[model samples]
Target: MTKTIIFDFGNVFINLDIEGAIKHTFNSFKIDALSEEMTAFNSFYEQGLISTKEFIEFYVENFPNISKEEIIDIWNFMLKDFPKHRLEFLKQLKATSKYKLILLSNTNELHIDSIKKTIPFYDEFKNYFDAFYLSHEINLRKPNKDIFDFVLTENKLIANECLFIDDNEDNCKTSKFLGIKTWHINPKTEDITNLFKLKSELFN
Candidate 1:
């Protein structure tokens, strides 16, 4: 039986328009694609190695014409609407108290600030989780074995007894490697609200 449930934040709980955001940023910046250096910087920022000020400064320096506020807006373009039903489902799930609910997300401070502003019930939604591990706070990101190991070690959880749900296949792949059961949720066609109904076999 699954004793612990790990949930990914973006695309699992909250929706993200990654493609749209990229397009908007490219259009605004007059660039075809983000440079390798720029991508690396973003990854570093997500890992909490760089501060938000540093993140914005990188963009501002690269795009000399862009202001700090514009850079922030562009960076936050990926976050989209968070449906209420998902939160309700989670609340109900937590009410059961059957499994330890943990939230593991590769998120930055600015993204979280944006989430709070966009999702009115963000605080209530967060209350359902027993452990909330943000990449920025934990200094670890998904798709890396270290992060998974940390989670298991920190919670004193056996890998086989944990179920991780993530929108990204790479993240799920690492979890599976560690012997953790995972559901690589397709946000386009699948809704996390159907967790129990869809994964009934897991519970049994």
Candidate 2:
């Protein structure tokens, strides 16, 4: 029986223009593509290995033409809207007290701060979760076995009894390999509000 539901924040709840963000970054930074070191630096930031000040400084030093304000705006451009119906669905699910609701997302400080500022019910949404694990806060990220292990161990949750839902295929794969049930949700055609109807078999 599924006793817990683990959710990914981006795409699963809030809409993110990942492709557009990448293109925007390339244009703003005047870079054709991100280098290996650049990718690693971003990963480090997401894992909370670097502070926001350090992250901003690194960008400023590398791309001398861009101001800190511009960099921050570009960084937070990917995050879009949080549909009301999704929150309502989550509210209903929380009211049931049927399962342990956990939110596990690979997010950074700047993005989170932007979310809090933009989303009026950000705190309310967070309060619904029994445990909320942000990658930056926890120093862990999805698709890394350590994060999955950490969540399971910390929460005393059985892998088979928990369903991990993420838009990232690799993340879902990792959770599944760890013996957790997973739903690789496609945001374009799927809505999280249709969870029980879409994954009814998991509930049974």
Candidate 3:
């Protein structure tokens, strides 16, 4: 019996354009691909091990030509829009009260700020959730196991009774390893416009 639904914010809720961001960064930096150090820095940033200032400074110092503002823009270009239909679907789900809803997103402050501006109803959507866990706020991230453990312990939820939904396969796999049921959502392949269709068993 699934009593809780854990949702991933990016892609699952709002669209993410990672490729576009990468292309924009490459054009700005005139680089073919990200350096090994940059990749490590990003991982640290995502894990909340490094502050946004530290992350930005590290890149600016390495790439002197790239302005801080430009870096911030490129970094935030990954975020797109939140469709009204998905918001309606979530609102309906919240009304059901059949399962506890939680949002677990691996995102930074800048991204969240950008999202709030783009989606004027961000707070209203957040209010619908039983818990909203942002990686930077919690100082933990997905695929680390610690974060999932924290959610499970904090919510007093049994892994078997929670279904985790994430766009990232690795995150879903980690949750599954912890005995939680998972739906590895592929935004390109699966349209969340009709989430109830995606998991009818829950409603049935």
Candidate 4:
């Protein structure tokens, strides 16, 4: 019946460049691809396993030419905009109290602070969710079974009765494997405001 809705915060809400940050890094380092170690460091940082200072230090150590401020700017370049209509949709959805809404986002401290400055209604948007779980804060991340399980157990939600929405295909696949229904949103073609209209069968 989809009594609970799990929402992803990145592309599903705020727009992201996804590759913009990497492109900036590659330009700064004159490298075409990220090293295996570099990828691991980012993953570790996303999981909140590393401190912000240490994460910044890794880049400082690798690219001595770039200042800390420049690194911070490149890292945060992926975040774009948060559409007001989406926030309105979420607010209306919350007001209805039709479902238990949970915001599950794979985000770090810097990105969040950046959004707060750009998105004036950031805190107001948060009030739309019954529970807000940020990966860095929770020490858990998306596409990880443990994080999904934690949300399920904590909310006393049956996976079959929940719907998860994310812009990442891998995340949706993982949630599906855990018995939760999913919508891998296409930001260009689909708007979350039309969720029920788009997935009418789910309601029926």
Candidate 5:
């Protein structure tokens, strides 16, 4: 039986303008495409291999004209509203105590700080999770075997008894490969409030 439900943060709980953010970043940097080194630097930041100050410095050094605040704004452009209804859904789920709830997100300090500042119920949303694993804090990320292993091992969970829900197909594929069930949700057409209805077979 599935006793655990692991969720992804972006596009799952909070809405994100992913494509718009990418376009904004490119426009701000005046670059046609992200160079390999820049992409590697972002990955390092996400994995907590570099400090936020270091991450900002890299951008400042590369794009000398952009101010610090502008860089921050560009970096945070992807984040959108977290609908209150989702919080209501999570609260109801937590009250049930039917399954262990966990949040596994690939997020960084700046983005989180922004969310906490803007979202009033951020703490409440976090408290509902039995385990909250942020890639920057854990120094691990999704779509990787090691991170999944960490979650399963740390929680003493059986992969087959867990359901991971992520909007990214690659991340879902990785979890499925590890014997866990997954929902590769499409944010445009789906809402997490219908979790039980959409994956009724697993719950039953």
Candidate 6:
């Protein structure tokens, strides 16, 4: 039986326009996508291996023309909105006493700051989770076995008894390898409004 639910916050909760942000950044920089640099920097930043200042400095040093504020704006452009319906769904899930809810997200400071501004009820949303783990704060990230192990250890949860939901395939794969049940949500097709249906399957 699934006694715990681990949720991923990006596309699962608030929508993230990663492609949009990349296009905007490329337009602003007047260059092709620096996919390699972005991937490397993101990995470091999400793992808490580098500070926000260091991450920004790396970008600034490579692209001399991009101002700090502009970089921050482009970086945060991916975080667009927090639909009220999603928040309501989460609220209802929290009200259910059947499962221990946890939130695990791979995100950095710039995106988080942007989200706080867009979602006025950020603190209230955060309060619903039994465990809230952010990649930057935790010094670990999704798709990494260590991070999954850390969460399991921290919560004293058995992998078989937990269900992890994420939009990323790699994350779901890693969790599955750890013996945790997973839901790899397809944001383009699946409606989060039907989360109660998932709950029924998980709980009943």
What is each predicted model's overall lDDT from 0 to 1? 0.93, 0.96, 0.88, 0.91, 0.95, 0.88
Model 4 global lDDT (CA atoms, 0 to 1): 0.91
lDDT of 1 by residue, 75-98 (tens): 899999999999999999999989
Deviation of model 2 at 162, angstroms: 0.5
Models 1 onward score TM values of 0.97, 0.99, 0.94, 0.97, 0.99, 0.93
Candidate 1 displacement at residue 10 in angstroms: 0.7
Q: What is the model-wide C-alpha lDDT for candidate 2?
A: 0.96
Question: What tens digits encode model 5's per-residue C-alpha lDDT throughout 1-204?
Answer: 999999999999999999999999999999999999999989999999999999999999999999999999999999999999999999999999999999999999999999999999999999999999999999999898999999999999999999999999999999999999889999999999999888888764
The whole-model C-alpha lDDT of candidate 3 against the native structure comes to: 0.88
Clashing pairs in 5: none
Candidate 4 lDDT over residue span 71-182, tens digit each: 8998998899899999999999998988999999998988998999999999999988999999999899988889999999999999989999999988999999998998
Report how far off residue 68 is in candidate 4 (Å): 0.2
lDDT head-to-head 1 vs 5, winner: 5
Question: Could you give the C-alpha RMSD of every candidate to the true structure, in order shown?
Answer: 0.9, 0.7, 1.5, 1.0, 0.6, 1.6
lDDT of 2 by residue, 128-154 (tens): 999999999999998999999999999
Any runs in candidate 6 off by more than 4 Å, and if so which? 198-200
Instruction: Give candidate 2 regions above 4 Å deviation.
Output: none
lDDT of 1 at 49: 97
